[model samples]
Target: MVQIPQEILDQAKELRAQLHAAPELSGQERETEGLLKDFLKKRTTLELVEEDGWFYGVHREGDQLPNVALRADMDAISGENGPYHGCGHDGHSAILAGAALACEGKTLGKNLFFLFQPAEETGKGAMQCREMLKKEKIQAIYGLHNLPGFPLGTVMIRAGTFACASVGITLLFQGAQSHAAYPENGRNPAFAICRLVGELSSILSPENYQGLVLATVVHLLVGEKAFGVSAGEGELSLTLRAHRSEDLALLKEKICQQAEALAQADGLTLTISYQDEFPDTTNPPQLCQRFEAALKKSGIPVSQLQEPMRWSEDFGWYLKETEGLFFGLGAGEDCPGLHTPEYEFRDELLAKGIQSLLTAVFL
Candidate 1:
C-alpha cells in the first residue's frame, strides 16, 4: 500500500468537511470549481486545465503522453435543508486531490490525468466532459464510488455492466377541454391516461429481454386541479432502466408505441421526450482483472460483486470512449444510503480511496 503523509490526510479531511458543509447542485458548481482549482494550484505541481465546470490535472515528464486517467465527481445532491453531499462526492473529490498531491514528485512510465467532474447526480457531467476527454488521448480511466452496507475499505467490482442504463421520459397528451357536466362535447384524455398507465406494466419483466428491463412511473399529472373543467391535457413521466443500452432502447420504443396507440384511440396527441439519460457502465474483463490485481497487491480487502448495481452512473459515458473500470469502495456496513438527507461521507475512507485509486493508476 502507498503510504500517504499524515499531513496530506489531515488536509484532505478538512477539505472534505468544508465541501460537505457548502454543497452545490449539478451544473451550478462554481464555488466548488473555484475551491478545487485553488487547492490544486497550491498543493500540486501539475498543469491545470479547465472547461465547462470541469477540470483536470496533468502531470507530464518529457514526451511521455498520459495514458491513464483517474476521475472523481464533484457535485452534491439537493437535500431537504439545502444542497449537501449526500452522495459522498465530497469525499471522492478529496481522494482525487490526495492522490494527485501524493503523485507530485513521483516517477512513473505513463502520464496521469486527475479529472474532477461536476453534475454527476443529474447524469449530465460526463457528457459535457466528453469533448474535453477527446483531447487527452486517455487509454484507460478509473473511478470509485463509496458504497454503503459493505465493509469499510473493501473494494467491490465486477467484470461487465458495473452500472445500469437509465433514462427519464415525459409523455405529454393534448386534448380539448370541456365543462365537467358536458364532457362529451370535447376530447378528454382521462381514458388515454388510464389505458397508458395500465399498459405500462407490459414493459416490465426482465424475461421479456435477455437482460433486466424495467419502466417505472415516476410522476403523473391528469389535467388541471379545478373540478369545474374536464381533464383535457395530462402528462405521464416514466424512468426506464436496463442492464444494456440496447435493452433500454427496446423498452423505450415499446412504451412509446403503446402510448401512441392509446392516444390515437382517445383522440389525443402524444409527444415523448427524455431527460437524465445515463448509459450502462461496462468494465472490460482485462481492465477489471488489472484493477483487482492492483488492489490485492496493495493488501486491500476486495469483494467480487455477484451482480451489477441497478443504479446508473454518468461515468458510463467515459467508458464508451476508452477501456476503464469503475469500482466501489465500501463506506461502512451500517452507513446510511446515498442521496438521503441523513447521509454523510465517511472521513476515514478518504485515505483508503486515494490509495486504491493511485494503486490502480500505477498498475
Candidate 2:
C-alpha cells in the first residue's frame, strides 16, 4: 500500500474542514472553486487548467501513456437554512486534491487528469466537464462516492449500471376559468389531474418493465386557494427513474402520452417539460475489472453489488463519452445517510480515498 505522509494527511484534513465549513450551492461555487484551486497550487506541481465554472489538474509523465481522468464533485446541496455540505462533496474534492499531493513526486506511466466539477446535485456538472474528456483524449476515467450503511473502507463495485437514470418531469394544464356556481362552464383541470394521479400506480406497475422502473408523484396542484373562483389550471410534477436508459426514455414517453390524452379529454392546453436529466452510469466490464484489480493489489476490501443504486449521479454523463468506473467508498454502517442534516463527511476516509486514486493510476 502507498503510505501518505503524516504532514500531507494533516493538510488534507484541514482542506476538508475548510470546505465543509463554508459550502456553496451548485452552479454558484465560486468560492469553493477558489479554495480547491489554491489548495492544488500550494501542494502539487500538476499544471492547473481553469474553465468557466470548474477546473482540472494535469500531470504529464512524458511517457507515451494513455490519459486517465479522476473526477470529484465540489458543489454542496441547498439546505433549509442555507447551502451546506450534507452530501459530502467537500470530502470528495479534498480526496482528489490529496491525491494530487501524493502524486507530485511519483513517476507514474499514465498521464493523470483530476476533474473538480460543480453543479452535480442538479445533474449539470458532468455535462459541463464532458468536453474536457475529448480535449484531453482521456481513454478512461474513475470516480467514487462515500456510501453510508456499509462497512467503513469497503469498496463497492457493480458490473453494469452503477447508478440509475432519472429526470424531473412537469405537466402544466391551462383552461378557462368561470364562476364557482357555473363549474361546468369552465375547463377546470381538477378531474383530469386527479384521474392521472389515480392511474399512476397502474402506469408504473412493476410487471410493465424488465428492470427497476419508478415514477413518483412529487407534486400536484389544481388552481388557487380561493374557493370563489373556479379552478382552471393545474400542474403535476413527477420524478422518473429506471436502471436502464432505454427504460427511462420509454417510461417518460408513456407518462407524457397519458398526460396528453387526459388533457385532450378535458380540452385543456398541456405543456410538458423536463429537467435534472441523468443517464445511467454504466461501467464497461474491462474498466470494472481494472479497478477491482487495482484495489485488490493494494489489499483494499472490495465488494460487488447485485443491483444499481436508485439515486441518480451526473457521472453518467462522463460514461457517455468514455469508458469509466464509478464505485463507492464505504462510510461505515452507523454513519448518517447523505443529504441529512446530521450528516458530515468522515475525515478518516481521506487517506484511503487518496490511496485508491493513486493505486488506480500507478499500480
Candidate 3:
C-alpha cells in the first residue's frame, strides 16, 4: 500500500463533506465544479480546463506517447430538492481529488489525465466530454462508481455490457372540458388517462423477453378546481428503462402509438417528449484486463459482477473515444441506495479509492 499523506486525506474528507452538504443534480453541477476547481487549483502543477462545467486536469508526468486517464463523476442524480448526498459521489470526487493531490510530483509512467465528469447520472455529459477528449492521444481511461451492494474495499470490475440501456419518457393528454353532471357535454381526459394507465400496465409478451412497462402519472393537472367540472387537460411524465436498447426503442414507439391511438379514439390529442438518451455501457476487454492486473497488483478483493444492472451511465460515450474501463468501489455494508432522500456518502473510503487510481496511473 502507498503511504498517502494525512493532509491529503484530511483535505479530501473536507472536500467530500463540503460537496455532500449541497449536492446538485445532473447538468446543474456548478457547486461540484466550484469545489473541485478550488481544491485542485493550487494543489499541483496540472493543466486544467472546464468544458460546460466538466473539469479535465492533465498531469504532465512524462513524455510517454500514450496517456492514461483516471476519471470520477462530478454530478448528482435527479430528484434533489435540497441536497441529499446519498450516492457516495462525494467520495468518488474526493478520491479523484486525493489521487490528484497524491500524484503532485510522483513518477507516473505516462501522461495522466484526471477527468472530473459532470452529469454521469443522466448519461449526457460523458458523451459531451468524450467528443472533446477524442482529439487527444489517450491510450486508456478508467472510471469508477461507488457500490453499496458489495463489501467495502472490494472492487466490482467487469468487461462487456456492465449496465443496461435506458430512456426517459414524458407524455401529455389533452381534451375538451365539460360539466361533471352533463356526461356527453365534453370529453373527460380522466377516462383516457385511466385507460392509458391500464393498457401500459398490462403490456407484456406471453413468451420470453419478459419485462414490465410502468406508466406512472408523476404530474397530473386539471383545469377546473371545482368538483362540478371535469378535467379537460392532463399531463404525465414517465421513465422507460430496459435491458436492451432495442427493447427501449420498441417500447417507446409502442407507448406513443398506443397512447395516440387511445387519444384519437377518445377524441383527444396527445403529445410525447423523450430526451437525454443513454445507451448500454460496455467495457472493453483489453482495458478490463489492465484493470484486473492493476487491482491484483494492488492486492484488492475484486469480483466480476454476476448480472448487468439496469442503471445507465454516460461514460458509455467515453468508450467511443478511447480505450476505457469503468468499475465500482464499495462504500460500506449499509450505505443507502442512490437518489434516496436519506442517502449519505461514506467518507472513509476516500484513501482506498485514491490508492486504486494511483496504482492505475503508475501502471
Candidate 4:
C-alpha cells in the first residue's frame, strides 16, 4: 500500500474543515471553486484546466491521452444554518486534491486528470462536464462518496447499477375559486388531489415495472387557508426513482398521463415541470473489476452491494459518456447520516480516501 505523506493528509484535513465552515449550494460554488484552484496551484506542479464551474489537473510526460479520470464534487446541501457540507463533498474535494498532490513528480505510465465538479446535489454538474471529457480524451473515469454506515475506510461498490435514476416532478392544478358557503359554485381540485395521490401510490409496486421503481410524494400545497373561501389552486410534488433510465422515463410518462386524465375529469388545468434529473449510474464490468482489484491490492476491506442504492447521483451522467466506476469509502459504522444537520465528515479517512483514489488512477 502506498502511504499518503502526513503533511499532505494534514493539509487535506485543514482544507476539508475550511470548506465545511463555508458551504455553497448546487451551482453556486464560486467560493469553493476558488479555494480548490488556489490549493492546486500552490501544492501541485501539474497544469490545471478550468471550464465553466468545473476544473481539472492533468499529469503527463508527453502528448499521451489520459487513460483515466478521477472526479470529486464541490457543492454542499442546504442546511438550517445555511449551506452545509453535510454530504461530505468537502472531504471528497480535499481527497481529490490530495491525489493530485501525490501524483506530482511521479512517473505513472498513463496520464491522469483530477476533476473538481460542482452542483452534484442538484444533478446538473456532471452533464456540464461532458465537454471536458471529450476534450481530454479520457478513456475511463472513477469517483467515490463517503458512506456513513460502514467501517471507516471500507470500500463499498458493485458491478452493475450502483445508483438509481431519479427526477423531481411538480404538478399544478388550477380551478375556479368559490366561497366556502357555496363551494359547489366553483370547480375545486381537492377531490382530484386525493385521487391522484392514491393513484400515485398504486404506481409504486415493483410488479408494475421491469425493475425497482418508486414514487414519493414529497410536498403538497392545497388551496388557501382562508376560512370563508374554498381554494381552487393546488400543487403536488413527487420524486420518482427507477433503476433504469428507460423505466424512469416510462414511469414519469405514466404519472403525467394519469395526472392529466384526472385534471381533465375534474375540470382543472394541469401543468408539469421537472427538476433534479439524474441518470442511472451503471458501472462497466471490467472497470468495476479493476476498482475491486485495486482496493484488494491496497488491503482495504471491500463490501459488494447486492442492489443499486435508491438515492440518485449526478455522476451518473459521466457513465453515459465513458466507462467508469463509482464507489463508496465508508466513513464510520456509527457516523451521522448524510445531508443531516449532525453529519460531519470523518477526518481519519482522509489518507485512506486519497490512497484509494490514487490506486484507482494507477490501476
Candidate 5:
C-alpha cells in the first residue's frame, strides 16, 4: 500500500469539516465548487478544468497511456430546515481531493482524472459528467460510497447490480369544479386517486418481478380547503425503484396505464411527468474481480455483498457509457445510516478512501 503522510490526511479532514459546516444543495454549489477548485490549485500540480457547472483535475502521464477516472459527488441532501450534509458527500469529495494530493509527484501508468461532480443528490450530476467520459477517452472508471453498516476500513464488493434504478412520477388529475350543493353537476376524482393508491401494492408484487421492485407514495394533494366548492384537481407523487432497468421501465408503464384507466372512468384528464430518473448501477464481473485483486494486493480487507442496495446512485449514468465499478467503503457496524439527522462522516475513512483510489489507478 502507498503510504500517505499524516499531515496530508489532516488537511483532508479539515476540508471535510469545512464542507460539512456549510452545505449546498444540488445545482447550486457555486461556493462549494470554488472551495474545491481552490484547494486543488493551491495544493496539487494537476491540470484543472473548470466547466460551466462543475470541475475536474487531470493527472497527465502520457498521451499514449490509458485514461482512468475517479469520481466523487459534491452536493448535500435536504433537511427539515434547509440543505444538509446528511449523505456524507462532503467526505466523498474531500477524499478524492486527498487522493489527488497523494499523487502530486508520482507517475502512474495511466492518465488519472479526478472528477468532482455536483447535483448528485438530484440524479442530474452524472448526466452532465458523462460527456467527460467521451472527451477524455476514459477506458475505465472507479468510485466508492461509504456504507454505514459494515466494518470500518473494509471494502464491500458486488459482482452484478450494486444499486437500484429509481424515478419520480407525478400524476396530475384535472376535472370540472362544482358547488357543494350540486356535486353531481361536475366531475370529481377523489375515488380514482384513492383507487390508484390502493393498487400500488399489487402493481409491485414480488411474483410479477424477477427482482426487487417498489412504488412509494411520497405525496398526495387533493383540492382546495374551502368546503363550499368541490375539488377541481389533485396531484399524486410516487417514487418507483427496481433492481433492473427493464423492470423500472415496466413499472412506470403499468402504473401509468392504471392511472389512465381510472381517470377515464372518472371523466378526468390525467397527465404524467417524471423527474430524478436514475439507472441501475451494475458492475461487470471482470471489473469486480479487478477491484478485488487491487484491494487484495494492497492488503486491504474485502467482502462481497449478497444483495444489491435499494438506494439509487447517479454513478450509474457513467457505467452506461463505459466500463466501471462502484464499490463501497465501510464506515462501521454502528455508524449512523446515510441521509439521517444523526449521521456525520467519520474522518478516519479519508485515508482508506484515498488509498483505494490510488490502488485502482496504479493497478
Candidate 6:
C-alpha cells in the first residue's frame, strides 16, 4: 500500500470539512463546482468542455492512451434538511480531488478523465453528460460511496446490483369549492387525499413493493391555510423507492388507480407526476474484480454486502449506458447513517478512499 503524504491528507480533510458545512442542493452546485474547479487548477491541466455546472479534467503526459473516466457527484440532497455532510459526499469529492493531486506526473499508460457532475440528487446529471463522453472514447469507469457499517480503510465490492432504483413522486388533488355549512354542495378533497393515503399504505408490503416502497406525504395543504373556508384545491407529494422495475411500475399503477378512484368518488381532479427517478446500480463483475484485486493488494480487508442497498443513486444510469464499477469506502462501525442531521463523515476514510481510487486508476 502506498502511503498518502500527510500534507496532502490534511489539505483534503480541510476541504471536506469546508464543503460539509455548506452543501448546495442538486442543480445548485455552482459554488461547490467553482471550489472544485479552483482546486483542480492547482493540481492539473483541466480544459472545460461542457459548461453549465459540469467539468472535465485530463491528466496528460505527452500522450493519451487507455483513456479512463473517474466520476464524483457534486450535488447535495434536500433533507440534508440543511447543510451537514451526513452522506460522506463531501468525502467522495475530496478523495476525487486528492487522487487528481496525487496523479500529477504519474503515468499508468492510461489517460485520466475526471468528471465532477452536478444534480445527482435529482437523478438527471448523468444522462445529460452521457453524450459528451462518447467523444472521449473512455474504456473504464470507477466510482465510490462511503459505507456506514464497515470499518475505515475497508472497501466493499460485489458483482451486481449495489444499490436499488429510486423515484421521487409528487401528486396533487383538486376539488370544487363549497361552504362549510352546506356539506353536500361540493366535494371535499381533504377526505379524498386521506382515503388515497390509506389505500396506498396498505398495499406497500414487503412482498409487493420489493426492497422499500416508502411513501411520505411531504406536502399536504388544503384551502387557503384557513380552517373556516372549504378547500377548493388540495395537494399531496410523496417519494417512492423500489428494488425491482416491476415493483416500481406496480406501485405507480396502484397510485394512479387509487387517485382515479378517489377523484371519481369525491369529484376531484388528481394530477400525479414522477420526478427525480434514479435507476438501480449494477456493478460490472469484470471492472469490480480489478478494484477488488487492488484492495487486496492494499491489505484492506473487504466485506462483500449480502444485498443491494434500498437507497437510490444517479450513478446507476451510467452503469446502464456503459460498463462500470461503483464501490463503498467503509467509514467504520460508529459512523452515522447517511443524511442524518447528527451524522458526520469520518476523517480517517479520506486517506483510504484516495489510496483506493489511485490504486484502481493505475492498475
Overall lDDT per candidate, in order of appearance: 0.88, 0.90, 0.75, 0.88, 0.91, 0.76
Q: lDDT tens string, model 1, 1-363?
A: 788899999989988887877799998888888888888899889999978788899888755555789999999888788888999999999999988888889887788888999999889999988665668888778899999988998999899998899999999999999999999987888788878788777667566786888888899998888989998899999999998999999999888898898899888999899999999998898878887888888888888887888899999999999877899999898999998777899998988898888888865
lDDT (10s digit) by residue, model 5, range 1-363: 778899889999999988888799999888888888888999998999989789999999899999999999989989987988998999999999999999889868779999999998889999999999999999988888999998998989999899999999999999888997888987877778999999999998888887999999999988888899888889999999999999999999999999999999999999999999999999999878988998998888889988999999999999999988998989999999999888989998999999987787754
- Candidate 1 segments whose C-alpha is farther than 4 A from its true place: none
- Angstrom error at residue 294, model 3: 3.1
Better of 3 and 4 by TM-score: 4
Q: Which ten residues in a row have the lowest lDDT in candidate 1?
A: 59-68
| Tens-digit lDDT string for candidate 3 (1-363) | 676799999999999989887688877889889889888997888899777778788878566556888888877655647545656777888999899999888766678888888777777778777755656577878778888767887788777777767777777778888888985888777777677777775553423244433334455565658888877887766677665566767777877888898889989888888866777677877777777887787786678887766677777677766777778777667877767776677776777788777766654
Model 5 TM-score, all chains together: 0.98
Q: Between the candidate structures 1 and 6, which one is better when assessed by lDDT?
A: 1
For all predictions, the C-alpha RMSD in Å is: 1.2, 1.2, 2.9, 1.4, 1.1, 2.7
Clashes of each: 0, 0, 2, 0, 0, 0
- For all predicted structures, in order, the TM-scores are 0.97, 0.98, 0.87, 0.96, 0.98, 0.88
Candidate 5, overall lDDT?
0.91
Candidate 4 lDDT over residue span 1-363, tens digit each: 888899888899899988887799989898999998999899888788888877888887667645679999999998888888999999999999988888888888888888999999989899888778888788888899998987888888888888999999999999999999999998888889889899876766677787899898899998877989988899999999999998899899999999999999989999999999999988887878887888788887788877888899988898999878898888888999998899989998888888888877765
Worst 10 residues of 5 by lDDT: 354-363
| Candidate 1: residue 60 Cα off by (Å) | 1.0
- By summed lDDT, the worst window of 10 consecutive residues in model 6 runs over 77-86
